[model samples]
Target: MPDSPRLHRAKAGRFVTFQFMPSLNQLLAAHAPLLVLDAASTRIQVGWLAPGSAHWAASFAEAGIGLFECLDQLQTRPEAAGAFVFCDGPGSILGVRTVAMMLRAWLVLRSRPVFAYHSLLLLAHARRDPALTVIADARRDSWHCAAIGAPLRRVPTAELPVRLAMPEGFRTWSTAPADLERIPYSLAELLPATHDADIFRAIDEPDAFLHEEPSYATWSPQIHRAP
Candidate 1:
């Protein structure tokens, strides 16, 4: 596989090196059949997505069993050695960290492009709404909330308004099934389309997010707890 830079500059009439940036089209064309590992929930889900594919193949294991173990087992299959997208999240810290660590290792050893997307981005893509709000349990007393096509933040569950109303005309999507008023979309249906560039742009830039190690987001003490 070619690791050529996206843009090269001529230094003294010689083309110097530059960094490589892959687009969604290139990724799909060069490495069709993308694998997705979503550990953003209590259940660690793994799925396969390809452009224009008619179906999405997926399954999950309990996070308590250890996501790394499940991923290791899944990796034994022939399809595991390829480009992948991982759900970098505000869910189970252990699960997300495990996958993130593995991806960084793969980047150094295999040089495969491992893209990360926020968990809410997946929900937003599934809802297919122009403006949307996604609220997921952040564990403890907070909620992992995001205004899709906008920004993300952690809000306290106690401060939730007395009435859960959509902001203006925006649609509200929540994983809380009891909130029957909120619209819920099938995650499986969106997995295939989730590999596009729009989602990739949400990944934190390498220079800003990665330094001593490859982290998916800006360093937050709350997000990155010392081990």
Candidate 2:
């Protein structure tokens, strides 16, 4: 699939991109029997979204083991699903990457459309609170911030709002801001409210979300001389 052109903005020493996604209802309508995976937090959530009803399974173990556990509980094979949905980031990088790697391997066996969504964006859409500022630790004294109607950005911790909502089970390195709200990050809890919310986007390749594409500078060989 061709890459979709996305709008990007530079903020807090990173380039952020605005992603648009379709809702749960929309996904079910078009692609029933969908297999959804979310390992963006401490919990590993797996769901089988079919017409009329959906089944959710979860595990709290480490990503590598927990993912398979949840999948086993669901008991649905990859080929049986019409399409696949995955949470792309703003949470556990290793967990997110684990899910992405599994999805890529599954794609090798059988090709299907895969969709991606940001963890904070999903929570924002589910909560439907205009004043709710969703945040996740971005390390280096910065955080990933998302609101109902704004693009996601990396903001310095000192600049964060007095009150903020963080998804449950997100790991934070710095001191949490005052008046921080911990919201449910489970798919079973969050997905119910997002039935009509547009928060999923189709992705050709699956990978953990990065604020900017990594770049490396070329080095040339030269004779060294001491001054």
What are the root-mean-square deviations of the candidates from the true structure over C-alphas? Answer: 10.0, 8.4
Instruction: State the lDDT of candidate 2 residue by residue for 66-127, as single tens digits.
Output: 98898799887778987888999989999999999999999999877688889998899888
Worst 10 residues of 1 by lDDT: 163-172
* Tens-digit lDDT track of model 1 for 1-227: 35455443233434322244344445555555556665655456665546665233333554434445554555543235456667666455666776676566655665444666666656665566654556666556656565546656666766653323121112223443234234333346555555453555323221112113645766646665788
Weakest lDDT window of 10 consecutive positions for candidate 2:
8-17
TM-score of every prediction relative to native: 0.58, 0.87
* Clash pairs, model 1 backbone: none
How much is 17 displaced in model 1, in angstroms? Answer: 12
Q: Provide the overall lDDT of each model, using Cα atoms, as 2-decimal numbers.
A: 0.51, 0.84
- RMSD over all Cα atoms, model 2: 8.4
- Decoy 2 TM-score against native: 0.87
